[model samples]
Target: MPSDSDLVTVPARARTSTTTRVAKVLGLLVLAGLVISFPSLAPDSFILSVGVVIASYAVLATSWNFVGGFTGYISLGHAAYSGLGGYGTALLITRADVNPWLAMVAAGVLVAAFAVPVGIASLRVRGASFVIVSIALVLILLLVFQSWGSFTGGSNGIRLPRPFGDDVLRPEQHERFFYLHAALLAVLLLCWWAIDRSRFGMGLKAIREDEDKAQSLGVPTFTYKLVVFVISAFFTALGGGMYALWFGFLDPIFQFSILVGSYMVLMSLLGGIRSLFGPLLGAVIVGYAMEFFKAQYGDTQAHLIAMGALLAIVVLFMPDGIIPALRGLVNRFRPQAASIREVSAAELAEQRRAAEDTGGSERGEKEEVRR
Candidate 1:
């Protein structure tokens, strides 16, 4: 019943797919090895430190994507959760004498719990209204943290003990933290990848495409958004707590700044939020650029201007992000027949007409032969 060519093609396609998968796995393994050994490969401690910063940014950006990328809700005040995490971890370590690691975990949990009520209220709005609500949340936290100086150290900020302690050399500390941050990023990436393939992810994408339609289709849009919001807060807070431990300082002004949230949004947008590695790739590029600008310009606010320009360029040109843009370019040039999905309605109509003409011609020829 099957055509001979199709039978041959099926096995060939399967083999090709298997080969491609193996190649991908091998490539990833090599990349992971390189990442793990980056500290040793780096020429100096500064490079290692930069790696830590990039890794932290990747974590934060990926965490942000859990909500921003999935639900299509742009939160401009996500730094509030991160700020809470930083303060919570620092306060626990300094005031309660808790272990730094335990404090970080606790901070994340607390932040996730705090996100529930916030998400309930914030998720009620959409578009600019949601964005405004998010920004207000951050501003409110900023004011509260700044004013409550008696407890939070006020404008002076609080000093956190380095989790690795003074016994560890600076380079070693950087190396250790780099690995810690990288490990967290890997876990988050795996979670994201898993979610991307699940029904839950499909629901999130549906909501992203059309919330009202998603709700009408029996998807619980609010619950899905809320769950993702809390999950995002947890990871984001962990990133903040880790930074607090590594940097040995917690300034509410810096922690709760809207700029931090903006960076997360920008990085995700630059890298292509829908793809698994988009944020990570964006983080590396943006983080490196920021550091390079700061190093070149010193204490001047030149890096902010540079980043703003970069963000503007990304939004204007690569709106879907770099990965998707690159993918489109690749597909455009690839020598392959277009899939049915890619075929235009006009093309499909033309194809149907051609097929019908061919069938009619064959039938006419058969009739002529019978005559």
Candidate 2:
């Protein structure tokens, strides 16, 4: 008895709700399996190392998503905060002999301590100017790290003892680190996903679309930026700690290089910047590609050349990345898929419209007879 519009719209919400529920159940099962298997079984060395690297990168990339992707701030200075985080906690855990776990806490606090001051100063500059200033800060910090030869080991770089015992770790240690990386990644993703769907994420999106409009709407623009900056730096620091742990060393080039910054950007861009899976895809693709190139070409430089080529191809052909590329291809190749959705909606709307029109005519006839 409803209008076509009403019937169609009613079903739209119901269909969406059903689809979301089904997706959630399947996603949960996959996540549970990934988490549960790590403790029970052992992964090969190559697999374990690769997993740690990808998982760690995912954390960094996802953190970057908060401000970079969602808020429209393309940050090339992510390395500055991450390196500071590594050095901050690395110093505490190494020199002060704090627990590595506690060191990670110190890293966050320290990164945030610096982030607040820097963010306050940097937020004064908008858009391109702000980005430039942030990058300059990274260079300045890197110089500072280099200058403090006693603490940071200057150009030579400082080292951190692995959280593992003094004895050379057995195969089990690699698996444990793999699980740790996985666990860390899962926790970070869960947090990011929640934020991405929350009121905060909505506010951030508004700010990204139009900061002036968002600010006019009583969104605390400065506060949100500061909070996102600190939170992003926090996770980046955690990932930095993981990086240091994985390699058992930290070098200035590794920590502060433009390449590291580029890697973060590349991962986000290649994966599908806005989606949750985007960073993961970018990391997996880029990571595996490097290994593949290294094996095939027998030179590290091959990665750079291959990456540049791949990036060019992706930018030219699939700038939206693999996910969007695949979706577009599916829609193009099988027009019926999207047509099916539109058809269903249109059909329901048409049926409801007809029902309403018929009911109206009946009412009119009945009224005339009564009269």
Candidate 3:
């Protein structure tokens, strides 16, 4: 039979876990409610349009997190997958005469299938080499699409027929796509939440901490990285396809721009890549700032400069990102979760003496029983 202390402690721990879970569920519900009500609350169509873009960025950032956040791969050309997804969807709709919605799904599947070989090759490298390979992928795709004038329209690019039809007003389209992007973000978040608590997530974190050590411990490091890489590509492609459908345009240069990939990286790093909502939080901040700068500065590179400054600030100060930094601050101030105090040599000695005395008493009691 267990001790009374054991019964008490176990129930306390269980109750803590349960309370944490309930709080998380309630928080998610509140967030979902806010997301659902965003368009209705927007002051204008332009604001609604910005909301759509923010939601889209949130989806892309979270998708990127599947690899970069979990496996610590830090891909610099995730735009390659998104570009491929957009082109695939466009081609399927134009050349194959598929329905736009169906084209998006088909494009996602095709892009995911393509990701397998790409992931296998990319996962062979690590660190800067992996980053270089990822960047090369987007560059290669960009040139390939650009040079294939007849098929891809070269620099001319291609335009998509809006999936929602011409009957929908621009503001209405923005509202609908905002919801669509939010739904996708919600799904990605749920998937990430599940993964974050699973054995697979543990393996990914092990890889992130030390890939060689993880492999030595039989974690199948390469396999785990590749799986996450592919999964990341899949969702990224879906986001790209959705964006293409909404925007009704696909310029290979813009679609595959290394800048887009950098945005995803920055967003994740800004918000706390390790946490479930880190990327989403980052997306909202980065996306709005980017859009705001662009709107205020016209076609100038002010947004780029702002982003660079933001990146520097994040790196220099909050290296752990906003969420973790805020968490640290909160923990610091919490009375019940007070910071641990250092013990002096005297204190250590006293603890040791107490433990030894307790052990001696236990032995004496046992001996007395034996007698």
Candidate 4:
């Protein structure tokens, strides 16, 4: 006969496996439904445009997570690559007459090329120094673009021709852009999910947890960080290019702003940086909140104040971010419930055995007295 311990352990393992599978299937189904229905269900162009904005930010946040969340290298200068991508795509399309799609790809490639040297240089530093390097890079790019009036349109910024041209109605244009952004976000998420489960991702996490320990264990920490950094830059730039095409304008000030960089970091942190879907969740919350605040409060400081409050709340209450905190809560209760059931069963078993022993002892005493 199987021991009680074996019986309990086997069922627990089976239940956990079944639960995981069911959860994954349900999650995939929900995601599929959203992807297929969002555009059709959206009420108007305004909603679609907001969706596009959310998706764009999602892509940015997720891409940023490639390096920042996974590798624990909080880069404050990712805007440099994003801005370059915007300008690169804009220039290629406007000056060279390339297709917007091709221009987007080229822009990503260009950003990745640029990231090689930057990653090599920046990855040498740690923590605060790395952050400073990132900020400096973005600042330099902002200054260069702002000053170069002839080439990049300087303070005037550059106007971009819409990908679908002026013939498309505003509503349709927004709908198309919304889908495009969704596709980009989907791709980013898929890549993140893949990497999150990969050996390479394990190395990145190792670096995130302890770089020195990772290196001692033969993980090429520097190489891994730099590679992830370049990959992050590539996707970030693609998102920037898409934004440029969508908005039909690009401004150096807005593109390379510290605020944009901060938003990427904040979104990732607010959602749960360690999880694959953290950035997407964060983007939805932060993106919608920003839009709502701006629409309601106009150009006042109210939005900023609200954002600050939100940040403070997240930091104070959910230090590990919403998803992780919620997960932790769920895990805590789940185990307790299981333990309660097991304890009750064990208690019943003990009571039965004790009762039998007591009854037998009494009977034996009665028999002895009779004898």
TM-score of predicted structure 3: 0.87
Per-candidate TM-scores read 0.88, 0.81, 0.87, 0.86
Candidate 4, 207-255: lDDT as tens digits: 9999889999999888899899999999999999999999889989999
Predicted structure 4, TM vs. truth: 0.86
lDDT of 2: 0.75
Model 3 accuracy (lDDT, Cα): 0.87
Clashes of each: 1, 2, 0, 0
Q: Summarize candidate 1's per-residue lDDT along 6-36 as a digit string, tens digits.
A: 2222333458679879977997898799899
Ranking by TM-score: 1, 3, 4, 2
Q: Which pairs of residues have clashing backbones in candidate 1?
A: 149-154
* Candidate number of the best TM-score: 1
RMSD list, candidates in order: 7.7, 6.5, 6.4, 10.2
Which of the two candidates, 1 or 3, achieves a greater TM-score against the reference?
1
- Residue-by-residue lDDT tens digits, candidate 3, 251-345: 98899899999999999999998989999999999999888788888878777788789888887888679899888786576445222554446
